[model samples]
Every structure is written in structure tokens, then in C-alpha cells.
Target chain A: MDWVSHAQAELRGAGYRPGAAARLVLEHLDREDCCRGAQEIFDALSTGGTKVGLASVYRMLERLDERGLVQRIDLGDGIVRYEAARDAGHHHHLVCGACGKVEPFADRRLERAIEAVEERSGYSVVAHDVVLRGACANCRD
Target chain B: MDWVSHAQAELRGAGYRPGAAARLVLEHLDREDCCRGAQEIFDALSTGGTKVGLASVYRMLERLDERGLVQRIDLGDGIVRYEAARDAGHHHHLVCGACGKVEPFADRRLERAIEAVEERSGYSVVAHDVVLRGACANCRD
Candidate 1:
């Protein structure tokens, strides 16, 4: 099977209810690989012929996020966005101040350092997000 | 100088706008280290006897954040919250799913690793955030 089918199967294997609606979301985000808001996803979904409603789109994505199938990104913009989590490994966020594009990244060193900081400080490090906003290649060049 | 004064000095050194309301905010956040939403801030300001208005608080915090004087944290909630960001050098966030408590941490190694990932992936890594949801001390214990 191809990667998309594998992904869909994995998600279903994890107990996600199926519909052309949720599948369209997963496939679109899988191919796009960019942080997208609900509206953007809805727009893309409609263009792709699923004809899903916005409320269902939002709800499906929310479930996906809860299931660890997606990640929610906040770019300091008024809107919230989502991206498919590449894996269960450590991931980080980068946001383009110029165009509001978001990218995900990972680093083990930072994870160790964070553990050390949590140990040193009384505050237990539970979770964190680091958003750097600046011009991206598309905006800069 | 006292800790609060030291904070003011830091802001001044960084060229951020400084004033009584800002100072008050710094002190409040230092004591709590909790993300206070803008409305909570307005309420606190009203009770603090500085005759501070909500708009003034908003503007002051905006300026402070621009200078990296404080941290603006988005909890994926509709409202963005504020904290002092004291010695907050390169930290991550941990959020409680049940209680809504947030903790900050730093992990340099993770930061570097994320940088490398961005580089290899053709993404320009600027900044990132990692948020984990779980129970906190108060909630768990």
C-alpha cells in the first residue's frame, strides 16, 4: 500500500472513525505539510470534492489533535491552525511573521536541556512551544 | 536595587517602554509566574490604585513583548496570556489538561536539534514551542 493508505489505515487502526470527510482532511494535510487553519482546511476540502461542512471539519480536526494525529499551532495570530504531527517524536514550531506560515521541527539536545532546566528549577517542565516569527523565503525573496 | 527595580532596569536597558503600570505587571507576574489573561490584568490593575486602564495595560504589554521584556503565551485558548519571562532563556511549555496550569522550561540541546532538522528539511528554523498536556502538582497530588 502507498503512504496515504498506510497513514489512513494507521489512524483507523488507532480507532478513528472513517468518512470521506476525515480522510480528505488527512490526505490534504499529509500532502500540504504546512500548518493550516480550520478555514484553510475547509476551503481545501471543498475544492477537493468532499463537500464537508465547517463545523464537521473543525470537530474532526479537534478529534485528530486529541488523538495525537495532528498538532495545533498558534502563530500569535487570532486564528488557530493545525498540522499533521510527523511522528510521536519531539517536534517544535516555526512561524513566518511575514505570511503566517508555520513549520515543524525536532531536536534532541533541546529536549535534554529542557529536562535539565526542569530539574534545576522547581517548576516541572511539562510541555512547551517556541514560536519564532520572522520573514520566510517566500516573503523575503 | 530591588528585584522589581532590577526588572525595570532590564527593560530600560533593552529600550522597552517603562512606566508604573508596566512595573506593576512585572511584579505581579514575578510573584505568580502564571499566565494572566488581559482581562485578569485589567481587573488586577483596577484594584492596584494606579488608575490604570485596560487599554493602557494592553499597549504597555504589547510594547514590552516587542522588546522581549515579557512572554506572550497562547494556551490554544481564545485569549493570549502574559508572564514576566524572567530569565526565561530558551524555554518550553508544559500545560495541564485538567487544571489549565502552565510551566516553563529550557532545553538548549533540543533547540539545536530542531535547528538541524529545519536545516535538513529546507525549513528555516527561527523559534519553536513544545506543549505537553498532563496533570500538575496541584491537580495530580
Candidate 2:
């Protein structure tokens, strides 16, 4: 099952009602490869004619985060961003410092290195985030 | 010369006066192997009988960051942390979720993978941060 369905099922099984706002947040996050901040999500949903409040978005994200249904990412800025959590197709972020653009990229070699670190350090790593910052191709020109 | 001396020289070259506060902040950060937040740095300095204000610490950190003298790190938490930037002895963080302990570990394999990504992605990756979260040995037991 996809992450949204799995998350819905998990929420329902945990006796929490999956309301429209919750579904909207999940669906919005599901469509994103890069993470979005709470305010950004709220603004997007509002622009899309949804009436979800910013507080509601934060609450829903907090709930999803508690259940490991979403990954919380900090782009070295003050804002906290959220993306759907997945076991496969894992990726990291490339942030352009000049234009504030974010892109997702995946690499198996990096994953192997992380595994090696876990084995060597004896820390049972449950989550990890990699953020690379620089001038993108567009900004570099 | 060490990172502190190099940073001090760079600041001087940039036409900025390296005040007593800046020197104290540099010395404190130089002694730490891990990153620390501005407030934490201020508190530590105050506890050690220094009278530098928190705003001065922030201003100093901003100046150093502009000169690439320090690295800014966000450990998936709300706080922004800083550490002295170095040419060698590069490392990433392994944070224990349960106890909130952050430990730095270095892996050349990871660096190679990042270099490979930069080559393939066409991004001029100038800086990067990796943060891994999990249970520490004591917390797991």
C-alpha cells in the first residue's frame, strides 16, 4: 500500500479519526518529493480552496510525526518541514542557498555509508537527513 | 594555524574588528567537538564568569557565518547550532532521540558518496550536513 493509505490505516487502527483535514495534509505531503513547512502547506491548501487553519496543520503534522508517518526535516533554517515517510525510495535534499530551491536526490552509496556508520558507532539509527547547500546550476550562471 | 586563528585572521582581513566577545566565542567553540546554539554558548560563557550578552553572540556568529568561518547545523530540532568550519576532520552527527545526546562521527566513504552526488547532480555543493537520529546504547538497554 502507498504511504497515505498505510498512514490512514495506522491512524484508524490507533483509534484516531482520519478527518478531511488530516487526509488533505496527507495527500498534499504525498504529492511532494521535497518537504514543505507548515505555513507553506497551509498557504498552498488555502490557495487550493481548502479552509484548513495553520494551527490544524501543525497539529496534524505533529500527530503524523509521532506515529512515524512523516519525516521532519530542518533545512538549517528556523522552519521545520515535513514529508511523507517511506521505507523505500528514500532520498535527501539539495538546497540552493541563493534561490531557496530544494531538490531531492537519492544515492545507494550514501545509504551504504550510513549503514557502515551505524555498525561502527553502535547507534541504532531510525532516521537520517542529509542536506547539501550551494549555488544550483541556474544560480551559478 | 588552527581554525580559531584562521577565523580571527579572516575576520581581521574582512575589515571587521574581532572584539573580546568574538574571541571568547571562538575559543569556546574551538574547545568543543560538537556544535552549539548561540544561547547555549552565551549561557556557558556567563556560567564561566564571562559577561558577553546573547545578542553579541548572535551577531558574532552571523559575522563568522558570512565569512565561512563556522558551519551552521540544525539537528532536526528548532535551534540553530554552530561549530567552527574546518578543512579536515570533517564529521557528521549521530543524535540519540531518547536522551538528546549528539555525537560526531566521521566516515570517508560518506564524503566520497557526497562528492559523487555533486558530480552527477551538477550542483556546486559547497557545504553539507548529515544528521542521524536513533537510540543510544544506554537508552536501548
Q: List-wise, what DockQ does each model earn? A: 0.36, 0.87
| Cα lDDT of model 2 by residue, A1-141, tens digit | 888889999999988998999889999999987799999999999999988978889998998998999888888777899889887867999999999999999999998988888888888888888999898999997
Q: What is the TM-score of chain B in candidate 1?
A: 0.69
Lowest-sum lDDT 10-residue window in model 1 chain B: B121-130
Query: Which pairs clash inside model 2?
Result: none
Residues B6-77, candidate 2, lDDT per residue (tens digit)?
898999999998989989999999998789999999999999999998999999999998888888888877
Candidate 1 residue lDDT tens string, A2-104: 4457657766788876677777777788887567899998998788677888987797788877766676777778988877765554466667766766666
Error of 2 at A103 (Å): 0.8
Residue B110 of model 2 has an lDDT of 90
User: Every model's Cα RMSD, please?
Assistant: 4.9, 1.6
Tens digits of per-residue lDDT, candidate 1, B83-134, equal 7656645566777776776776555666676566556644454444555555
Which candidate number would show the highest lDDT if scored against the true structure? 2
DockQ of candidate 2, scored on C-alphas against the true complex (2 decimals): 0.87
**Regions more than 4 Å wrong, model 2:** none
Query: What is the TM-score of candidate 2?
Result: 0.94
